[model samples]
Target chain A: MPYVNVKVAGNLTEDQKRKIVEGITELLQDVAGKPPESTYVVIDEVNRENWGKGGKLLSDKEK
Target chain B: MPYVNVKVAGNLTEDQKRKIVEGITELLQDVAGKPPESTYVVIDEVNRENWGKGGKLLSDKEK
Candidate 1:
């Protein structure tokens, strides 16, 4: 089983989540011959305050 | 940089999130010699309907 984890700095609509899940599943299946039904896509809606990049939190970077 | 994703069936409190991040960072550093500063820990709270096990949705399993 292929486990895919996607992290986003903010929220996503249900439609967006659906599209992302579908897209990732298709990509893995096409590129690596993974089974779509067996692939697991876990999306994380991370708070900007908790996400760090370039030694700074995303929230700080936005300021 | 090492990226770690943790998937949970339910939500977590802010304190719990903090501990998980800290614990994972420490584990990676001590076990794999990864740098805590550059390591990324992301936690995803997945809905029962979206998570599947044994070809059945987790929501259905609970019913």
Candidate 2:
């Protein structure tokens, strides 16, 4: 079983989550010959305040 | 920057999550020499219905 975990710096819509799950399953099936039925996709939506990049929290970044 | 994403088949307590984050950070620091400040840990709690193991959905497993 292939378990795919995706982390992002904010919440995502249900549709977005659905697409991600589907896309990852397809990709694994195509590239790694993994079966879609056994592929698991989990999305973790991290708060901006908790996510850091370049030594800075995502929340502190200016838009 | 090292990003860690943990996926589990069910919900976890706040304490458990905290410990996981800390443990992962420490492991990365000790083993990979990654700095704690630049390391990010995200935990994903997946529904049993969505997770499969041994060609069977986790939800379908009998207790």
Candidate 3:
């Protein structure tokens, strides 16, 4: 089974989530030969406060 | 940079989160020779309804 985890720095709408799940699964099937039925796609929506880049939290970027 | 993702099937308290983050960061530093400051440890507390195994949703298991 191919377990794929996708992390993003905010919330996603239900429609967005569905598309992402489909896209990632299709990409894996096309590139890695993984079967969609056995693939596990776990999406993580991290809070901006919990993620950081360049020594600054994503939560602070909006300021 | 070594990016680590830790997924669990429920919510975690702040204390639990602190411990887990520290543990994973230290593990990578010790085993992979990665620096703790540079390693990224992302924790995903996945809801049961969003996860499945053996053709069954984890949310159904408790019922």
Q: Provide per-model DockQ scores.
A: 0.12, 0.13, 0.11
Model 2 has a clash total of 0
Clashing pairs in 1: none
Q: Write the per-residue lDDT of candidate 2 for residues B1-63, one digit (tens) a residue.
A: 798767889887655666677788888889999988888776667899999999999888955
Query: Candidate 3: where is the Cα deviation over 4 Å?
Result: B1-45, B48-63
Model 1 residue A60 CA deviation in Å: 1.5
Task: Please list the residue runs of candidate 2 whose C-alpha ends up more than 4 Å from where it truly belongs after superposition.
Answer: A1-7, A10-44, A47-63
Q: Quote the lDDT for A49 in model 2.
A: 52
Q: What is the CAPRI rating of model 1's predicted complex?
A: incorrect
Q: Taking the tens digit of each residue's C-alpha lDDT, what string does model 2 give over A1-63?
A: 998878788999999999999999999999999999999888878866554444444555554
lDDT for B51 (candidate 3): 54
Candidate 2 docking class: incorrect
Q: What are the lDDT figures for the candidates, one per model?
A: 0.78, 0.77, 0.76
**For this target, which candidate reaches the highest lDDT against the unseen true structure?**
1
Location of the lowest summed lDDT over 10 successive residues in candidate 2 chain B: B13-22
| Model 3: per-residue Cα lDDT at residue A63 | 92
